[model samples]
Target: RIDAETRRILLLELQVRPGIAALQSEQLVAKAFKTKVNMLRSLGSRVVMTVLEEVLPAAAREAFRKATSSSGAAGAGRGVRPAASTAAPEPMPVAPEEHALAARPPPAAAPPNAPQPAAAPHAE
Candidate 1:
């Protein structure tokens, strides 16, 4: 009886996990669509990121970045100024030959000892 219950539970779990994942995916897609529409509405027309970067002045861009980065950290909640820490900002190392960050390899496959899905019971 316990074995049958365990199999039933596993089957239900397999079905439910996929359904939950699908619902979450749909919600994310809807959010992305809404955000894109809002961006288009605010911009007055569709504009690529590169075009905006080229058009906007460097000072304006830097000010925008600073405002965005600082707002959540310092002005979150009641808009109190956050205390500054003494730690120095870490420097990002770039590849001298490529002038860009190093590329990461794809994720490794599951280990040999990984648990695999149980086989479906025969309908007979």
Candidate 2:
């Protein structure tokens, strides 16, 4: 049978092994976290550089070019123009029937007999 002192030594050794293993596990987790944080930081820096160096300058240049090339008319600052209507233009002489209809006043609202919509409830 093992002596009491030897048994105590073995117990302590066993305890130490698990403690070392836990410490190693903690170290691994910390390393992985650090690596992930660094990778994210690098990615964020790259994205910022791409936007500031490439995308922003390109967009600014395009906007400047458009503004400079736009028409000289008043209120034409941004190179944007009002879209022209695709529908047919008004006829030179207005039709008599159409003029009469246009001159007539709009019809009145629903009669008193008609059911009215329910009013929405107000919240506090």
Candidate 3:
């Protein structure tokens, strides 16, 4: 256990100056903001959460929303999963001649004697 703690401490020590020369400005900002977050966490104030939300990407925000929904921690931002069909689909157009045929339900399985597509001129 002491060895494991020492390794963890060394890992954090190595990352102490993270993003000092990152190509992107966001990487540097994220690292700096993390230090402030640690301070806020230690002080036990949740006000920083609002600030944290501002830094998260849209994809991460969406994943967090989904996770919150599944974890039953939902409230104001309840993570209700979207319904399969929230909007009714528009009905497809059917040819006048095929209206009667379309009105009938389709067969569950094709009979071996069913007409092949090659036998129908309008199959296409």
Candidate 4:
């Protein structure tokens, strides 16, 4: 049997828990519960997140949820789009000859007509 104390406790608990809506409800009990919840929600209780969206009519919020969930990257409830990521460009392919040349040391500058070492012949 439900008592005044039980109802009072449930109402107080509702402030911290929005899911306090009872699963087992008779017609009268449900009506009483809804009335109490509506009163509390109308006062913009911190427990009910709907207070932040009080400016929007209920239908508009539902529609936005559906629209964003299906096709848009729109963030949850904030109406913001996710940022796109940028990729680095692929490197150009290096030729074998060019690579060898680039790896070689720079030739030293010599005085005019300075004697140079003779090139060694490759063995067959």
Best by TM-score: 3
Q: Better model by lDDT, 1 or 4? A: 4
Better of 2 and 3 by TM-score: 3
For model 1, the run of ten residues with the poorest summed lDDT: 41-50
Q: For every model in order, what is the number of clashing pairs?
A: 0, 0, 0, 0
Model 4: per-residue lDDT, tens digit, 24-109?
A: 33434555777776676455433233543676687886775576567744543342234446887789999999999999999988
| lDDT of every model, 2 decimals | 0.57, 0.60, 0.58, 0.61
Candidate 3 vs candidate 4: the TM-score winner is 3
lDDT of 3 by residue, 3-62 (tens): 555445544655645545544544444555577556665643234445547988778867
Candidate 2, residues 17-114: lDDT per residue as tens digits?
55467677545545555665566555554344455566567777667546645736663433233567999998699789999999999999999999
User: What is the alpha-carbon lDDT of model 4 when measured against the actual structure?
Assistant: 0.61
User: What's the CA error at residue 82 for candidate 2, in Å?
Assistant: 37
Off by over 4 Å in 2: 1-20, 45-124
Query: Cα RMSD for candidate 3?
Result: 16.4
Ranked candidates (lDDT, high to low): 4, 2, 3, 1
Q: CA lDDT of 62 in candidate 1?
A: 72
Error of 3 at 19 (Å): 26
**TM-scores for every candidate against the unseen true structure:** 0.22, 0.22, 0.24, 0.22
